[model samples]
Target chain A: MSMPALLDLYRVQARMAVQQQLQYRMRNAMVLVGFLTEPVVYLAVWTAVAKENGGSVGGWTSGTLAAYFIVWTLVRSMNVVFTPYGFEWRIRTGQMSASLLRPRHPVHYDLAYFAGSKVVWFVMWLPIAAALALLFRPTLRPEAVEVLVFVVAIVGAYLIRSLLQWLIGMVTFWTTRVGALFEIYMVAELMLSGRLVPMSLMPSWVRDVAGWLPFKWTFGFPIEVLVGDLGTRALLLGLATQAAWIAATAGLLALAWRGAVRRYSAVGN
Target chain B: MRALRLIALHLRVVAMYEMQYRMNFFLQLFQSALATGTGLVVLALVYAQVDELRGWSRPELLVVLGVFTIIGGVLESVVKPNLVRFMEEVADGRLDFVLAKPVDAQLLISIRAVRFWQAVDVLVGAVVLGVGASRLTPRPGALAVLGFAAGLLFAVVILYSFLLILATSAFWFVRVDSFVETFDGVFQAGRWPIGIYPGWLRTGLTVVVPVGFAVTVPAELLTDRSGWVTLAAEAALAAALAGLARLCWRLGLRRYGGASA
Candidate 1:
């Protein structure tokens, strides 16, 4: 298919996904609330930490930390990927057959669903973010160039993290017990992606490792850009690294998709 | 007494089912380790930057985390699995079978599904507590041990009552799963000392949510800061909550029987 055609298909799929999510408003709201809790708690923790440490730690004052976390919440919300736990159930329960019969690839449906769901959640976050900004009185001063760069980086980070997690979810095709693997990945991301704490405060070696991995680019780099920590050189480097990981993971996902489809013996008719 | 034996038997059956999936044991271990590790590393990273957080040293915070994990383990192993199933049963009318049993219906439903694998969380929590204790300057004495035990019991009572109250709401609000999810979200705030939060948040966590009384108060007892009056207050609050939960459960059961009509 031509690039424009594929783009149009994606847009249509996204619209459908959004509508489906709207049908389950209560469930979507609950999930959105669940997603908001983590970032807010971290915001509170770091804000307290910064306040206690003479009002600044690692170039983040309490206000700056609040701004960073508020933005972090929005960025992270948009990037929420459904874990593969449900995928295994789909295969076991014969839902995969229905997906295979669809006109578009199942991944396109998922992508559409993700896009639609985030639109709903992003609306929910705006008021919460505004309330936080008012209460916390965060200091946010970003140049127009920095704002543009941060937006681009945020989109890149979302795609990279989603593709990486989608690849991980693909493991359900091979193993029924991927729960442990998923938990391990979550813990690692919680640590390395600056979900629990900013990478700035981690031990030097830990920060170095985070920089080398795709996880940091997923969360840390985007937040750092918003906070004005990433210089021109680092911004370019971060974007390059994000692109590289996206390409690599996209390739791996395609390969895994082919293998999983070939090995697909439907369970329990 | 016979009811206790029946519950024990039920637990044994569930234990056997869990043991059959040997890989589940490993999964439990991995999950507990990673969860505990993430909390510890976050604490470590924070302390590395600042010597003290709201006057909580690294080891003191570790003790708080240890207690948090231990209480969380107890909730998951005993309370959560059963309460979740009980909620579903109430929704689907399957609870009739449970109610018709010779045993106490509440007791049967509350302890029905035992996830024995969750004991791994308890074991890991104990290890963390041990490691945290080793790093303390003055070792906790017999009195401290006694206080810790009492405090832990009090915390468990609070958690059990909280879950019971939340689960009983299922009878009224059949779609009360989101209530449990909200509770879970609120409980995550307990990972740190409640004192560190702003005054408004501290009040919310302590009275409204009871997150601090579940984990932090017990840790304080072990570390020799908690007074007898505070412990007594927490114990009393737990008892009140439990009593309230029992009353609510009775009321819910009556409604299920169409008694209001």
Candidate 2:
């Protein structure tokens, strides 16, 4: 009822969620290792390409490319959301019914779980990233202003990507084969978000379409911010676009949750 | 003869089950189109900045991409999903039923769960290979085709052994899904020619991970550039790995008291 009581409940939930995540330390470590490999491999490939192309391609020097992808690794991992497991398991086992019966909205619990789990992953991943930075000798210019903007963008990107993926996972309420859809989404993210390659290297039309989509803001824009590639106007525009997507996706998630709950209740899952 | 009949029956059952979901066929087609489009676009983007990467031209790299997709399709459609389930079954003790069957348990378990929708990837890969080969210098010859087929078979065997070893770990570890995910992540590096990477990475892909043999060596064969010794080594490695995987599976089953004799 009161704000303080609500905050207390959130705190308690967060602690429990964090404890649950810590129980699977080995699995978490393996996943973090797996996550780190992607960015590292891409960094190597792009570095070679840059070398072969006379030390820079698309305005990024070898060192900047290294910095971009290394930051990309850490930022992307921080924004990683595991909504499918919770969504699918809840739907399959009728745990969602109990959640719906709770006093608070179900998303509160999910958000708490997401935040707590990311806390665990972040602790484990930061050192790995630091080690990579040292080994690769990435030339990083840690601008204080850019760092602040990057932090904000990272938080914004996490919210937007998580909400969107959660909404997609909600489709499990309708179909049993959501895994395929999830895979397709991952492939799209790998391309559009500059996870596979930098957006500047892609065709101009492809870049335009990717920029129009929310996926770019999730990884590409933030990495650009960290790399000092985004000018003043572009940085502001990126933040604005991220905010717009967060709002739009949050609204869609609400509508989808309402419909999904109706389906579950009426059809008796 | 009876094993052939059982395999046929399994195929029929899988086909009947999959045919009910016509939407899946279209969904897989869309997904494969997106995947192929993204790979090609990335390659085009990379080549836009450079004339050659480690002496491989654009068309040569495209050929590599084609083989990678084709091998990936075969693995997903025939080997991966089934062996993944087989690993789960091994954990749950249901693999005993498979072992008790009259047919060869390995063959049965390996081919039992085909997602026929993955045929789209195979078809798309064929088209990509066709286009890529057409763009190659001197064109592909009969020897190249034979080498490509042989290299493909060798690649499939290597991939199968890699997966089996990973899945067989479930017999001991009981939680190998993460290992599979790690494999998937590492395998993404195969999209490029392995020669482009540094020495350590090249060695890891060839000897440790075996992704190079699965995708790159075959592509090299298709381009008619790889030496006979490379093909021979790849085949030898595949055979050795497959034999080792079989031995591990047998030992793992022994631990569960599923030994036949």
Q: Of the true interface contacts, what fraction does each candidate have?
A: 0.45, 0.60
Q: Please, what is the whole-model Cα lDDT of each candidate in the order they appear? A: 0.81, 0.82
**Mind giving the per-residue lDDT tens digits that candidate 2 earns over A1-269?**
67887677778887887899899898878777667667877877788888898888888887888888888887877787756766777777777778788887777676666766777877887888788777677778767878888989998988888888888888978873477678778887887888788788777887888977888878888888988656778878888889999999999988888888778742235
Residue pairs that clash (backbone atoms under 3 angstroms), model 1: none
Candidate 1 structure quality by residue, lDDT tens digits, A39-77: 767877787788887888888888788878877887788
Instruction: Point out where model 2 deviates above 4 Å.
Output: A84-89, A170-188, A229-241, A255-269, B1-5, B257-261
Task: State which candidate has the highest lDDT.
Answer: 2
State candidate 1's TM-score: 0.94
Every model's DockQ: 0.54, 0.50
**Per model, how many backbone clashes are there?**
0, 0
Docking class of 2: medium
Q: State residue A149's C-alpha deviation in candidate 1, in Å.
A: 2.9
Q: Give the native contact fraction of candidate 1.
A: 0.45
Clashing pairs in 2: none
